[model samples]
Target: MELWMGFYLVSFLNIARCVPESSYTVHLNKLSFEKAQNYCKPGSFLTNIPNEKEMAKILKTIWDENSKTDTSFWIGLKKDKGICVEQHLTLKGFHWTVDNSTQSDFKTWKVEPPVTCAILRCGLLSVEYSHSGAKSNGFMDTTCRNEHAFICKRNIQLECPRPEILSSHDMIEPKNDPYTREIVCRSGARFNLTCSKDLVWTVAGNENVDISQLCLECNKGYRRDASGNCADVDECKESKPCEHECQNTEGSYKCLHSYNGNDINEPPQPPTTTLKNRGNSVQTQPTSPPDDVRTNETVLHIDESAGDISNIVVPAIIALLIFIVLLVIVAAIVKGCLRRRSIKLARRKAEAVALNGSSSMEKVNEKEET
Candidate 1:
C-alpha cells in the first residue's frame, strides 16, 4: 500500500508538471518617473527594498531565477528632495556635498557608499534579510543605473473542470450509436458526446456539415440572398419608397428628405412636359377664322389703329393750335399798344396849344396895364 501511494504521488507530480504554468515578466529599461509608475499600475506592485516582508519574497524569487545581486534595479522610492538637491546630486563631483548627510526617509541610499565628490545615484532598496523585534536592517541599496532581477506576483494556474460522464442508465443514447449519447439538439440534429475530455463533442454523422449553410442569418442592414449569404440591400433602389432618398446604414437604413428643392418629399428632376397621343392618325384643321368672329376681330384691329392715330395726331394738332393762338394774342396786344400811343400823342399836342394861348393872353393884359 505504501509503494502504491508513492507511485500515485509520483504520477500526480508528473501530471502537475505537464500542466502549463501562468507567469509573466517585467523588463527594466531607462524609464522616467511617470513610466515607472505606469509599469506598476494595477496587478503589479512597485519593487521596494526597505519592506522586509516583501523583500524576502523578492530575494527568494531572485535566487530562484539565479539573477545577479550586484546588478542595479529600480524601486518605488523617489528622490523627493528639492530640485536643488536633485541637481546637486546629479552633477558629477558634487556628491561630496551630500556625503555624510543624514539619509532621507523616502530616499534609498546606495549599498556601496558613493565617493565623497561623486554624483549620487538613485535606485530602489532591496532587503537582504529580516531582523526580529525592530525594523529590518537587511536593506540593500542599488544604483538606479544597475539592471537587476525583480519579482512579480500572479494568480496560480487553474485546471479546467472535468465534464461528468453519465452511465448507460442515465445517458440518453442516440438511435445510431450505442456508445455515444446525445447531448444537445441543434438544427434537427443531435450533438453526440463521448469520453474524450479535450476534444469537443460533435454530431456523429455531421463531420462534413457545411458550416456556412448553418449560419444563414443575414447581418444587420443586409438581407439573405438566394445562396444563403448576406448581401447589401440598397433601400434607395426601391422606387419612391423613401420620401426623397434612402441611405443604407449599419443594421438599418435611413430616408434622407431635405427641403432643398420644390418638393421636400420628392427628389428633384429636370423639367419635363407630358403629352397624350390621341391616335396614330394625323388631322389638319382649318386655319381661317370663323365669319362672325372674323368681323369682330377686324373691328377690334381698326379700333386699335384708330387709337394709335389719336395718340400721335391728336397731340400734334393740339400743339399746332396752341402755337397759332399764342401768335394771334401777341399780334392783338401789339396793335392795341400802338393805337394807345397815337392817342396819347394827340392829347399832348392839344394841351400844348391851350398853354400857348393862355400865355399870349397874359402878356397882352400886362402890356395894357403898363
Candidate 2:
C-alpha cells in the first residue's frame, strides 16, 4: 500500500515545484517622507532598508554618479505612534525595521546615534564625500520634512520578456507554460530562450522543471515529438498504468480497478492483489476471462459497458439497502405502539365492569328495604 502510494505522491510533487518570480524597482526622483509614501502604489511604499545586503544592492545599482550631487534618500522606517527607543526600537515585541510584515534581526545603523529630535522620525541613507564627490552610502535618521530622493520597492511578477526578433519579423506568439517555463516557440521554430539567474527555461509540460539549465528535455511522463512539441506520454497505449485499466491525463496517467460489477478509479487498490512477504512487492493476477484463451498480449479483455453499469448499479444497491433497514425500524415501532394501546383498553373495560356490578348490588338492597 505504501509503496504504490509513494510512487504517485512523489510523481505529482515533482511537477508541483515552480519558480515564483519577484522583482524590485528603484525611483530616481526625490520626494519627502509623506510625498514618497503617496507616490508609491497602495501595496508598495517607500523602500524599507531592512538589512545590509539590500542596502548594498541599492547603492550598487540605483545610487550612481548622478546621485553624488544629492546624496541622502528616504527609507520606509518611521517612529510608530510617536514611540522611540534609544537603543533597539522594538514595536509590540517585534522589530519595526523590517518591511512587508516580515521580521528580520538585520540592522545597519551608523556609528553615531540617530537624531534625538522627536520630529526627525523618518529614516535616511547618508552619502559619503569621496574623491569623485558625494556618494549614496549608509543609514541615518532625518526629519520627515527633509526633501531627499527616495527608493520604492515592490513585488512584481517576473516573466521572460518576449524576444524582439520574433516581434520584428511578425512571428507567432510563443506559448509559455508558467509552471515549468517550457516555451514552445511560434511556427514550430526552436528559439533558444535563456532565462536570467535563479531561473531556467525547462521543457515545460512536465509537473517539475529543471531550474539549473538553459533549456532541457521534458521530464518523466512526457516527451517531445519531431517538431519539438511536448505532449503527454500515452502509458495506456503500451500497457496499463494501473493493474486493470489505464487512463492517460495531460501529463500523467491513472490506474483503475473493476470489482463487484463496478469500476473503482483508484491506484494502489488492485483487484486480486497479493502482497508478497518478500520485499512487500504487490502482485496482481487477472481474475476475469481465463488466461488460457487469451491471444493478444497487449490488449486486456475489458467490458466498457461494465464501467457504466457499475456507476449506476452501485448507488442503486446502496439506496435499496438503506430503504430496507428504515422499513424494518418503522414496522417495529408500529407494533410496540399497538401493544401499549391494547393494554390500556383492557384496564378501562375491567374498571367499567366493577362499577356496573357495584350499582346493581346497591339497587337490589334498596328494593328489599322498600
Candidate 3:
C-alpha cells in the first residue's frame, strides 16, 4: 500500500508545474473598477502590485511609451474601513482582489489623496514615463465610478489564447483531461490536427513540423528553452510569489510557511474580509470570501461566482449611495436659488404696486385743488 501511494505521489509530481510568475493582460478598454474586475472573470483578476519585480516587468511593457504619460489604471486594491491603521506612505488599510490579502509588501504612494472622502477609496495606479525613460508609478485613491484602462492578472497557469483560424479546418478538443493547457483546439488550412500518445499535436501530412511549434505555443507553466524543450521555469528565483520561504522541487516550488511574527491568538484572516472606509467612521465588510476549499471545476465555479458577485455588488451599492448624495446636494442648491429669486421678484412687484397707488392718490389731490 505504501509503495502504491508513493508511486502515485511521484506521478502527480511529474505532471507539468505552473510557473509562479503571473501572466498579465493590460486592457486598454476603459471601464469602471468593478466592471473591469468582472470583465477579467474566470481566468484572471485585477493585479495587485505584489513586489518590485512584478512592477518593473509591467513598466517594461506598459501598453506603449506614449500612452504611459498621464495614464491611470484600476488595480485590485481598495480601502477597507475595518482596518484601523492610518499613516502616511501605507496601503495596509486596503485589500487586494486576489486572495483578499490586506498585507502588502509593496505600497508606493505619490501623493495620498485626502482621507476625508469615502468615495475615493478604490485603488488607482497612476503610470507615467519621464524624459529620461524612467517610469514613475504610484497608488492613489479614486472613485469606483470613474472609467479607466485597467490590468488583469492571472497568478496561475493559463489556457492557450485561442489561435486564430483563417482557413477551413477542424479542431480536436481534449477528452477526460482538464489540467493540460496544450493546443487541443487547433485549426489548419492544409491538414487535420491530431494528438499523439506522447501528447504532441501533429499535422496530418507534415510529420516534421509540430503544429504547436508553428503556433509558438508551450504547455502551461513552461516555456521552450534554448534546446526547444518545454522545461519548467524556476519561479522561486524568477517570480517569488511566496510570502515566507520557497523550496524548489522536482517540477515546481513550494512556499514554506514562517509561523513567526503573527499572533496565534489573533483570528485567522479568512472567510470574512474587513475593509476600511478612510476618513469615515464606518467599517464595512468587503466581499472577498474565504479561499476556495474545493478544486473541482463545478465547485470552483460556484464559489468564484459568489465571490465575484459579492465584490461587484458591494462597490455598486456604495457608488449608488454616492450618486444619490450628489443628486440631493445639487437639487437642494437649485431649489434654494430658485426660492430666493422668487422672493426677490415678489418684493419688486409690491414696490411697483405701492408706487403706482401713491402716484394715483397725488393726481386725485391735484384735481381736487384745481
Candidate 4:
C-alpha cells in the first residue's frame, strides 16, 4: 500500500514537472547525417530541439531504458555558413533543420562552440548522466560525416483514422499555428481540435459537441438512403452526364457511343518521341504505348456481303421521293391560286365592258328623242 502511494506521488510529480512532448521512433542504425536525413524520408525527418524543455524531453526519451551513463545522438542542426551569429542569445547562429527555420532561445551548451571555422558544423546532444538524477544535457558541435544513432519524428496534432479521411493525411495540417484542425465526420458533422507541440489533441468546444452523432458515409459512387445505409447511386437517372447513351452498373455508369452505330468510341493513340543518348549526342525515335496502356476494344464489324447497299440507298431514295412529292404539292397549290386570280380578273373585265355599252346606247336614244 505504501509503495503504491509512493508510485502515485512520483507519477504526479513527474507529470507536473514535465510538459508533454510527442512520442518518436528511435532509429539505432549508425548512419551519417546526410544518410540519416535520407533514411527518415517522406513522412518524418530528424528530430528538432526548439528549447531546453524539448531537449530534456528528448534526453528523457532516449535515456529512459539506460539512464546510468553518458550517451550521444544526432539532432537536426547544421551550421549555415551564410547566417550571422548573435552573441547575446542561445543557439545564436544555428537554426532547426525544418522548413520553417526556427531557432530556440533556450540553448544550453555543454561546451561553447568555437566561432572559428576550424570546428565541425553539425549539432549533437551529449548527455553526462553519470548517475540517476541528472537533468542537464547540453548541445555540442561535431562533424556531420561521423555515424551516429538518431530519431525520426513528426508532430501529429490531429489523428483521424485511415477510413475516416476522404484521402490520406487530410486532417493533418502541420502549417497552422498552434496546430489547429477541423475534421468533418462521415455524418457531415464537424469537430475542431488543436494541439500545441503535443501528441494529444485538445478538443475545442468539447462541451457543446456530441460525438455520438457520427454517421458513416458511403464510398464513391454511393450515397446514404432514407434508412441511413449505403446505397448505389443512379448517376444516369440523377445527372444524365453521359453524351449518347448511359447504362447503369452496380456502382458506376457506362457511356455507349457510336462510330457507325457501334457501341463504343476508340481513342486514337499518339506516337511518342523518345530521346536516345549515344556518345554525347542524342537521337529521336518513335515509340508505341506500353502494353498496359493499350486497350482492346470490341467493335461490330461492318458487313460487306451484298453488292447493293439497301441500308444507304433505300433511305436516299425515300428522301428523294419525299422531296419530289413535296415539290409537286407546292407547285399544284401555286397553279391553283394563279388560275383563280385570272378567272376573277376576266369576270371584272366583262362587267365593265357591258356597263360601257349600255351607257353609250342610252346616250344615243336621248339624242334621237331630242
Best by TM-score: 3
- Candidate 1 residues 235-311, lDDT tens each? 55744355445666555566565544556445444334444457755554434444553111111112134355678
**What's the true lDDT of residue 178 in model 3?**
27
**Taking the tens digit of each residue's C-alpha lDDT, what string does model 3 give over 202-270?**
454444654445435455566544333457867789887666566665456665543345653333354
Cα-lDDT of candidate 2: 0.54
**Which wins on TM-score, candidate 1 or candidate 4?**
4
Candidate that scores best on lDDT: 4
Q: lDDT of candidate 4?
A: 0.63
lDDT of 4 by residue, 26-117 (tens): 66678888898877654457888776676666767766655444366777877766555455557757666865365675567887776754
How displaced is residue 202 in candidate 4, in Å?
25
Put down candidate 2 lDDT per residue, 252-320, tens digits, no spaces. 666556554544532233337455768787776754555674322233334365356788989999999
Point out where model 2 deviates above 4 Å.
Answer: 1-22, 63-66, 89-105, 111-120, 129-137, 156-370
Report how far residue 360 has shifted in candidate 4, in Å. 99
Over 4 Å off, model 1: 1-34, 83-121, 126-370
The TM-score measured for candidate 2 stands at 0.34
Clashing pairs in 4: none
